[model samples]
Target chain A: MGAIQGFEIRRSSASLRGSATQLRTLPVVAKYIDTSTCIGCKACEVACQEWNDLPVSQTEQVGTYQTMPSLQASYWNLIQFREVDYQGGVAWLMRKDQCMHCADPGCLAACPAPGAIVQYQNGIVDVDPEKCIGCGLCEPGCPFDVPRYSERTNKMAKCTLCVDRVEVGLEPACVKACPTGCLQFGDKDTLLAYGKHRVTALKEGGFAEAAVYDPPGVGGTSVITVLRHGDHPEWYGLPKDPTVPVAVSLWKRILHPLGFIAMGAALFGTLGHFMTVGPKKPKDTSTTSGGEV
Target chain B: MSDASVPASAHPAAPGPSIMRLAVHREDVAVGDEIVRHRLLSRVIHWVVALFFMVALLTGMPIYSPVFGWMATLFGGLSVCRWLHAWSGIAFSVASAVMVLHWLSDMKLVPHDLKFNLVQYMQFSAAEDPEIGKYNPGQKLFFWTIPLVTLMVLLSGIPLWWPTKFGSTLRQVCIIVHDVGFIMWFVAIVGHVYLGTAAEPGTFRSMTRGTVTKAWARLHHPKWFRDVTGDRKE
Candidate 1:
């Protein structure tokens, strides 16, 4: 369940050198969600909470069918219910919201704590609570806005893609509990082929903009969805094109190495100056006691 | 005067006057041929700033990069360092603020200071301009850089401490600000320490014992040497 040796870690957040050597022996896994078929019944959400043993959070009457506005620290999964004007009438767009677990995970890239966030060979991104220092870098690092900071534990929490279950050859709890055949899990390549076929079927069935939601900016995600209106992903509470934030990218890529160089230069510059120029001393004191005032 | 091993209490005039001296009065004074560059109060504030700055640096470096992760062990762990860095950072900021306010008048750049070239100063070929005051222009520049960098770190750090209070965009900006500010501050401190100790022979005692020899004062700060000693002879 924890730090399974069977799965090779592809990346470890803030690792000094690099993460464990990726064998790439495991097939990349993914979840296929046909959002067009979802009936807005949040069985997946309940299954996630139950399997993970997350504490129940209080929900207020927000005058909407949605249980809550967004995912919380304890509530790792959510079913976003967005009402949009479609086909000249109001239509409900229900999306099962959770971590995308990107191929190039921003949360992992932005994290400064060693082993706080990790991506396994099977493409599962997980946060280790014990290692998380809760600096909240992951909050801004995520392009999909998945990670939630737990004030109680002083750490960041997010959907682990159910690594505990996946390790035992079991499908994620949410995927297993889905009743409408809307959610399916398997190898990433196989799921993408299935999702694309569904998208083609939707396009032929009068939805012209139907497309597979596998954003290439993030190198694609483990959770690929077939959206009826993929042209307007914002309608489904997803970014049209999501990439790691430029600030985070620059900070991790450029600044980290530059900082070391800058500090080294300061040390060497001072040392070089001292070695050549020597210490400044009074000229007339050479003949005297050298200590004479 | 060269004996750094001499304790602060050994200075006959060091203990009494500064105890009752008001904060408004300048601490720079002379006793016989020895000049008091920093008073007891000034020395205390200076050390407090140094101590807290070191604490902040040690705690923050671990969080900045995993290469220094071992540093977290010195202060319990990474989680402990998270809060310790913030609190120590605040202490360093406040101490720096007090330092800036206390030395503002002395640090103001005059027309002569405008000609102070850093490249020329590093050569160490000639004596100080004789017109130079309590601190050289280079030292004053470093003094002013302290609060500028501290304010950047402090302002950016507040948003980081309570991430939920601020937006993601602001938080990202603060991350950059905090890291860049830290690098600049660290480099400046490195140069400061060098200049305060090894770069100048007698400079360390000014902070340690709050005094410098008349020769040290005359060589480093000639104009202030005249002001303190009333010695018109160059």
Candidate 2:
């Protein structure tokens, strides 16, 4: 639901650095969703589809009103319905789920295709299908499991935060359709301030664990979810402290350069040896190849 | 010419036709007394292994990192590289397996190999001890290490090629192992190429032409040379 006026992509997948153009500065935009006030209406989901002009996906009931099992290639925004045991009875916890668009996006880091993933100066992360090779690297790269691969296109699909509408000085479709006023879109700083105020208000209203769930393990995210139980993100099926996978970090930061160094040293050392020592000569020159044997 | 009727030392014309004799397999009538160091089948299998190894290396490097992404262009793109790398790795493993069995009979390390000093060899100070066989300790060590390393590469590569079949944690570990195995193979192959070609003269031709000069065999593998030619006088 972020408004991304006057923004250019600031950070992007490093593989696409050769083609991507960088901007000097831009205001960051963000989406703030108050989960405590969410009604699980599926309005945002419909709005996302309508605005994006996506096709109706065939779905079957899986023992719950929850639309599809989880996020699908056709559905970017979803309302996760979970029945939790309250003080005495069961209570429904509905959280609107979408891409987090992290400051340090693991998908961007792990992507091998150039320009396949990009982050805007306003903090909207987008995937360029033209550059995508359908390698599915972004699937495992994401800690949140937000990106889904479409078999039809053989490319990754995820939430773009209504980047098109936000680019034209309008709020995202989901924010406009939220009847409960739970979804808010604005400059990142203003939204953070408003989110903080809302969390305090909820805490005062007898919600003990009411807090802003902007996880810092991934350097925070553009989408901030205000949760009633922020301490236990796992209850919402979110990683408690989601960070980039260990192998991805080691592969990109450590092994990438280390491999080059090792190969270079070996090649150069061998070359030096060949130049210095020359070739070993056969000691006995008297006999021919087919000797007494 | 290496006339089988006369001593090579007495034939001054040996040099003139020794080059032509390379066209035939002279296991008995050495090219001016040059020995058939490697047989035709042995040379063919060695090159087959080398070809597969190089193919695997070039194709696998790009998939490992975007830094080497240009290599993908050679095979069309990363998608093609992914499949090509898998097939090449399979071929390389199979060829290496064949090479292991083919060379196993001669590659065995003897008690003399325990005394082989790499430091002395590197400094060009080691004498040609008659105990050395068709292969030195360094070559034998590489021969033994490669099959193990190649198997590791193949096993680790399997998970990466079909990641979803395995757990995420195991897939992550496999990626690291595959990358490490790739680097290890790179180092080993570079050294092998250098030793076979530039470092040791007349060594590469044995694998290509399937023969080496008697003088080369005598200097490099004196014991093998003595066994073949019955020339113990080093």
- Counted clashes in each candidate structure: 0, 17
What lDDT does candidate 2 reach at residue A63? 73
- Which number leads on TM-score? 1
| Model 2 residue A110 CA deviation in Å | 1.5
**Total clashes, candidate 1?**
0
List, for all models, the DockQ compared with the true complex. Answer: 0.71, 0.45
- Candidate no. 2 TM-score: 0.86
Residue-wise C-alpha lDDT for candidate 1, range A87-194, written one tens digit per residue: 899878999999999999899999888888888888889888888889888999999888898888788888888888888899999999999999998899998888
Isolated chain A: TM-score per model?
0.94, 0.90
Candidate 2 lDDT over A143-189, as tens digits, reads 88787777786677888888888888889899999999999999888
Interface Cα RMSD in Å, per prediction: 1.0, 2.1
True contacts kept of each: 0.78, 0.54
Off by over 4 Å in 1: A16-24, A286-293, B1-26
Ten residues in sequence with the least summed lDDT for candidate 2 chain B? B1-10
Per residue, candidate 1 scores C-alpha lDDT tens digits across B1-234 of 111222335555754454224112335566545667787778888999999999999999999988898999999999989999999999999998998887788888888999888898888887689898888899989988998899999999999999778899999999999999999988999989998889888789888777777788898899888777667798
